[model samples]
Target chain A: MATLKDVAAKSGVTVTTVSRVLNNRGYISEETRDKVYLAMKELNYQPNEIARSLSKQKSNNIGIIVPHIEHPYFARLIGYLEREAVKKNYKIILCNSHAKFEKEIDYLEMFQSHRVAGIILCSRSVDIGKFVSLNIPVVSIERPVDVGTTSVECDNYQGGILAAKHLIARGCRHLVHFSGIENEAMPADARSKGFIKVCEDNNILHKEVESKADDYLNMEYHSLIESVLKENPEVDGIFASSDLIAAQVIQVARKMNIQVPDQLKIVGFDDVSIASLVSPTITTIHQPIKEMAQEAINCLIKCTEDSVVPSRIQLPVSLIKRETT
Target chain B: MATLKDVAAKSGVTVTTVSRVLNNRGYISEETRDKVYLAMKELNYQPNEIARSLSKQKSNNIGIIVPHIEHPYFARLIGYLEREAVKKNYKIILCNSHAKFEKEIDYLEMFQSHRVAGIILCSRSVDIGKFVSLNIPVVSIERPVDVGTTSVECDNYQGGILAAKHLIARGCRHLVHFSGIENEAMPADARSKGFIKVCEDNNILHKEVESKADDYLNMEYHSLIESVLKENPEVDGIFASSDLIAAQVIQVARKMNIQVPDQLKIVGFDDVSIASLVSPTITTIHQPIKEMAQEAINCLIKCTEDSVVPSRIQLPVSLIKRETT
Candidate 1:
């Protein structure tokens, strides 16, 4: 936590002199360099590699890889992380992978060539091997890495169970779960599994309806819901993978004149701001967005040091019940 | 635009040499530099300053200043800008002013000290004088700067008049407008003014109830609406400053069992993603977000090149009718 000023004061030199010494740039005496080095060591100061690199390498910027910033969940998550990053005095280069493998790789390579401080991988594309090859600090959001790079994630399985249990408690019998893109990371996949596991344990008959949206706002979700409705008209309970998907379900249900909760209980994931704004509101599982963001920053900061940060750390998820269920 | 590779091929030199020549970095022969410069001019190759700045400044970072990133309006705007920034291979550093003058000043100082290439000011809270003194290219989003800084804003006054006209068309006799914070240099203020002007022209009995929220959340909105309702029970139509605020009106109205469109017609601003997601949807003014973002970026780039960009530019705002009004 020792700042550049602290080290400068301790070393009996100007902040700029200490910065130069730390960066190994500009003309400075060996004695002054030695003094600053000793001062830094004694204070346990880790020069902001990003800042230092930014000053010396001239582009100490890192890229934040996300699927979409417009999505409510991602927007809130980005907001928290942006605040934390600003506090630390690091610039974030935002990358919207748009879930394209080529774009993801392009961003990683761009970050590598541009000399960013680190990579915050919020994208679902799990191509960690390529990132590792770049020899940069990679802190993934939600998606956990197995090879010792820092990661911050939410307990998706727990969130799934919470959603299912809320519906089950509301006396839902013929239930169905609306999932996001299948064959993805543990986050969405785990949520689906948890729902099934909870349904089986509670001895409830359940069916799965996977939506084709990348995350949420897609024309396919409405058609998907319509198709699902045709086959599962008796389905009295529903759990959507996202708030956007849940919003679509609500619209579809309204068109069909099905009253929420009274006729059909519904629960959504990622209790975004829209959850309460929508009519009938929406019961949703709330991921610890601010906490997770802070944790991601903390993990990356830890990675900056020699500390061994966890590769996969799961934060708690809570079910926020509104009017829907 | 011709790429670096195209320039290099025309100049009969390697990409690295062309890059170095464009960046004004490293030692290159005079003849080679001349060739590259001539070739660039011939091909009309615009160098990516971001890529070049990375090598020289150690952080090819662009900072974005928004009032609040959590708000869907700003969030979606940031998302679009982020996407565009990514396309140009630049990283985004987000700073939230929370609509505070002091915070805006702090971020300006921070971004300057942090050596950001440029800043995109989205609804800045700081005075125009401070911005003029920075000697940096700044693109203001939705706020006009008195100084010679480029700005991209929506036609707020027109939007307001349109909303009022819509209410009148809906057979509203007594109308109330929910305005934004006092003395905020936002289009919302102009919107309220336009509403009043339109009402006066039509000889309509209209009342303005300005309810300032601490931020863009539903915190003060509900209470504000309650008080407005108590004071203006005869109010048959409502014009809210934001979609989020409009959604709160729905919540409050439902609590009182007031029928929307039948008893009271409501209209909100900023057709954000949740505008349609919310129940009864929302009949609001649509700000061309994507085009605005691109314009802001283009303006900033022009300013960087010492070009004369407009001090005030207003994009069109359309009234989209959904279910609300």
Candidate 2:
């Protein structure tokens, strides 16, 4: 139960100097900082971060809301975001909204009460209007929130274009693009739009099959993929919106006795680890997850500093060729 | 800019009543609580959680330190932990230490300063001595820390036995168990011990191949698995330490033209999503991740309440039969 005054007395410094060292604010000599730390260690003094945050009116915490952490894409994104946040000495308060709007709102209220420096929204279940009145800086990843909220997303449209062009270049005649849930108005929906435009411009026979919300929630698409392949035997190429779906396609193709890269070519997006771990490693669109995460943190910090950052930041994506192509 | 006094005045209540409503402590009528909330909403008053925590000397946060968030096992564990935490109105301060001791220590100090109610240690890199002087409740997951620390873990030893017995029951002779890093006193190492014991009792020829730390961090076990399979062609049954390694084994076997379950029956540990997602779905030992997570949180909470709880909690595991076996 040692107080700040006790540490200052033990370190032979003023209380203000001890507080400055603890806050890491005003510049102090390296020797003085070392003395304070040594005294704290010897006295077993634990500074109250809550009191410090209350005095500063800001906490070194960034609220992160994601739909699901078990999903490979979100898992990778969260990992990269944590790494980037740690570099900036910011901790993340994780909230798994599970794509539930009520849960998202509950977490938002908690973040506000806790006075987090910023919020990084990875779940798109909540409406953009919910954040309109939020005093905290909000940064949405992959999903654009609103005109005032900053968003960091890879070029989903260009990723779709690259996947379609790659499949066509590999001599695919009939192609199918497996999209996410229909009518969601997500930023990722642009991938489907880009795919359709490319197919129409190339004058190639193509079809778009949308996955349901259940498929996403359960991370199970084998049955849907099996049916799609059975009904469309003529389809020789597929562009899946996620690597998880692409992996499922590969599994279904293996069961159907359809030879990949011989009778069919496939491309996946978000080049997560599964894209390469699966056999006949998937050719996928790399979304620059690390860079996107860094940018999201940067945008949130900048917004916290009262700096004007661009509302929309679209990083580039690249097509990674593997055995699937 | 709104204060508690303002909210109390607008609600036609005393400041004490408003404080009680905000803290949900003293008994208050539902109508009066609603009035306080309405007044706060009208005034856009955000109650400062930091100040409240300072007064209470506690925080509704559980600090969680994990090796890697992107790893499937840890990802699923974190998801379940978050769900369990949310149920109890507690938030998680996520720290991905990446199994770095220094980083873990840094996060531990931060957790202490922040006065986290408890800490859930998922990373096993730090020594048990580190938690000896920690004033907060420390619950270790899977790995036992010390006599004072509560640990929640699935029956890893029994899981190893189950996998071996299942493989042997499927008419396999030569067996190989792929273990984690050597010389690490992890709870998972019990799997290797159990596998060896069962093999020895059954008079089955068995070999153990240890995966290096690099194989784990990179999640790349293709070359190691390929080499082992190539060198030990006589090995007809394999028990992998994790589903990730099992998936890689499948990929390597495919490359070597080895038909699974016919030429080589494989069983993996940790029934994560990837187990079923991969073709020739892995037959793994199912760890009750949800139950374990709940138990860990329950233990931490019980400790916080100064209740006597068991030091070690070992949950049951089961064998999941799939195409691999």
Candidate 3:
């Protein structure tokens, strides 16, 4: 294998000059840089990136921790993140925290040891103090953090308002909102707040139901949704916090002999692939997933350089009308 | 920010001894190791993994390249791989090739530069010779490679037989098979061979339709499948190569007012989450994704320790009967 010494000898330059050219540490003349490049090309020398990272005290890798990779929402988010990271010449180190606090702590420690350039946290079980003490740049997605970390999310509250208004405009008198796990303190909780505000302002009848952590983890809400539908036969509209839950609502409605968009109307959030793949093709609030991913990467990079990035950024959301509504 | 020197001073040992203890490179007495551990704990020392990896000439990162991270099959596979990798104290460096030749080459070069312990290739666009010459241990999943690389795949041929027999046993005479793109040379192509042989033995009227590359990449097979159904109105049974395609078949059938399992019976492959999540729940062949992921990681780790390893490993598949059949 070709070494740095070989490239230096071939280029007729000192090893320090070659090292400086490789690291871009000190200014080098154009002629010297061109000569070094030509020598490196000729010798086919591949610099050891680990050694370079050790000297520079940083790696071009970003640690990404997600609660569940198999979930469509996170899966799509990760895909967009990978695409944007490649554009910025960064790689992703993936960790599945499974929504467990201990696993999140373990992964945070691992990231510290590896000296990753930054972290993107999609899970929200860990304490904010742990991330603050790590002293590494972090960007949380859809999870609000304290002063030390930056966050990027969609307009969840606005999304809820849109869903409620759409259902009302479609002549739905009785509405129901299926929310995420209770007391999780996620930014998504604002969704129900927005929905309730719109319902109260319109003087409409509405109810809010919270899904349990087990239902979220297992991705099974059939029984819960079925019970809700049976108890509220007059309910004509539902706004689910996620597309997965919305798909289940459609399934449960079907089993109960309720026709969608005729007897019952539905609107889902996140606008993931399942929203369209389902039978009724659910109407949904389109969260700017790709944009949020790009913003998270950009924020982490900015924090690495300046440490003065905006602490919170909320992008706009829109309603995508499909067959269901 | 305690350094090696600080730990050595606190433990009353040489810096070299502390380094050896950290890397587990050389023999050290239990008492001396215990003293070093106590010193590290008291000083709150964290070893820089980059420096340790440089000294060892290898990293604890396993490079995983997949064609599409948002696809449910690959997404589920990655989730399982991450879980298994964690058990072995390894981390995953994720790359999405998007089924592009240039992207695969770029990621391969980057993995080489980073000195990843091994690579798991889920994309098959790159030349096999590139992997052979890199002198790195590689394991290809569901993608067959020539000599100098290990491969892990489910029994695709057997899966095909199971799908065919299940459809036939359900009293379907006229059948149609929707295959992947033509001339891709993926190990999955064996599915068609098995299906064809079974059809020939039974002398059942059957037709095979090939999906274009765009359909697979975009995950939009509605038009293609609808056209096939229109042309082959006598086709009473259908077997799709992937759960995604099968879901599209159901959607197309519904649009055409054709009742599933009453007028048409269907069987899908891969049995990913999408299979069960879709309406009516697809009956399909299960690929044993978790076991395959474990085997792939184990094969890569074995290759790192010893150059000799099983060139190819084929795990078993099964039939998962559901409402579709």
Candidate 4:
């Protein structure tokens, strides 16, 4: 709790002398350094990092803004990012936007005020205009906002193609894809598009059943699956946008006495933890989450240092064949 | 990027005058305030919050230390805490301990050096000894430490009791509880203790089979469930410490053709999003994550105040029956 001034006063020297000793900047006599050390030890003075950061105009900290921490995918992504951030000797300031525009703007302003070295926008709530105006190196998770910011994302289109191809390999002719959010720049939309493309290329019968769920919440997944099942009674193979959605599909399948991987071969995306934990363990697209997280953090740090890196970095996705497929 | 001195020099005014106008502290004339504002606008002067915080010897930021953010329970809890902290005009600096004692200590020291308002430690890594020397309010979740600090947690004992009573009410004659951890200051242990007590009171044939998993990882759950099934053949009913674990139990049961709620009644703790999303929707104990998170934030804020408030807040828990039990 002791300040530099207190240590200086105790050491009978000016504050500049104490600062020089702390920063090891200027020449100081051995006696003066000893005196300063004694004063610091006596006063229990801890160097104020805030003051140091202010002086350098750069804090060894990064800010991460996410839509919601509660979502498992984002939570896992943040966990990996936090680990990577710490490994790079930088701390993280976490802000939850809750998928709100005003909250995202408030976090950006706050991060600026906090003098964050850079920011990683995991939430796609803010507009491109609001994002580009910050003049900070922002690495977006999914939303490719502007030209200048770096982005780290999984190949959703490839993931979708893999899902449909696996279903076709399993000899499924009739297919229905359950997708949420159509008009957004989300990876799920890309997945749906890829599914359709693959289905069209292979000459397979495919029907798209779109739902208006904001991510994969339980209530939303339940309602969405219920409606999709009601409309498409003869659909055999199902490709869900998220594993959470796929779990819902399985739940609905059980209720309707429809056997999975036989009566219906279901494939999910984002091989989240629950994918393997549940019954008829989900066959999902494994987004290289840890690698992508590390890449995003490294890109942000690089941009903060040099600001010369490309704006977009897309990682590959692969199929994790489990019980469902 | 411009400093106050730059603005002051541009406006031909003293730095003190500019500072006063910026803080709105002194009785400055409207013309003088406008002149300072114009100069600030022209130079794009942004006030340094870090500098101001150093000068004030405090910051409007709180530190949150959690073991892993990927865990659904912790993620939801952190989400709630973040919203509450934002509402209270405080920012959250996140530190992932990764369930390591050294990492927790390192993060604690770093947060202290940064002069964070207070630290809310949701880690189960270290005991009270690691935090006894710190001159900061340390509110822990699930595990209370350093007697004087505030703690906000769910009633784990009651949660355990609720799970046991529900299973008994559903006419479960044989019961077995699975735990990932043996014994620590773990809420799961408390739940286990309560369950054992309830079974004893009712004179039911009760048994406990702890898993080899260290934490709530998916692979851990898989191996744990495999061992549990192999070890306890007469375990007609199961109570897993987490929904993920319970989901694994369901998967294992299905593989062994043990019908849920009919042949093998199972209950999971921490009714996370996956609980309802999974098939044979897990009958589990619901942790009051939102309320507990808000309380943790409020407690940290109160601890940050000059006069710290020391209190132990136990949020309520309940049983949400779906289909498994």
Candidates' interface RMSDs, in order? 5.8, 1.1, 1.0, 1.5
Arrange candidates by TM-score, descending.
2, 3, 4, 1
TM-score of chain A of each: 0.82, 0.95, 0.95, 0.88
Model 4 stretches astray by more than 4 angstroms: A2-45, A125-135, A213-219, B2-45, B125-135, B212-219, B307-310
lDDT of 1 at A194: 93
lDDT tens per residue, model 3, A30-79: 99999999999998788999988998889999999999999999999999
Looking at model 2, residue A30 earns an lDDT score of 99
Collision pairs in model 3: none
Clashes of 3: 0
- Please give the CA lDDT of all the candidate structures: 0.79, 0.90, 0.90, 0.82
Q: What is the lDDT of residue B278 in candidate 3?
A: 78
> Per-residue lDDT of A1-325 in model 1, one digit per residue for the tens?
5789999999999999987886688999989999999998897665444454444543445568887777888888888887788778665777777777788877776776566667899886566785575556889887776485877888999988998888999999888998767565536788988999999999999998665445343423777887787788899999998888888788888888888879888899888888887888899999889999898887776766657888787889998889888
Q: State candidate 4's DockQ.
A: 0.69
Error of 3 at B101 (Å): 1.2
Docking class of 2: high
TM-scores of the models, in the order given = 0.84, 0.96, 0.95, 0.90
TM-score (C-alpha, index-matched) for candidate 2: 0.96
Better of 2 and 4 by TM-score: 2
True contacts kept of 2: 0.86
**C-alpha lDDT (0 to 100) for residue B275 of candidate 3:** 87
Candidate 1 lDDT at A233 equals 85
Question: B38 in model 3: Cα distance from truth in Å?
Answer: 4.5
Model 2, runs deviating above 4 Å: A24-34, A125-134, B25-31, B128-134
Q: What DockQ, on C-alphas, does every prediction get?
A: 0.34, 0.81, 0.78, 0.69
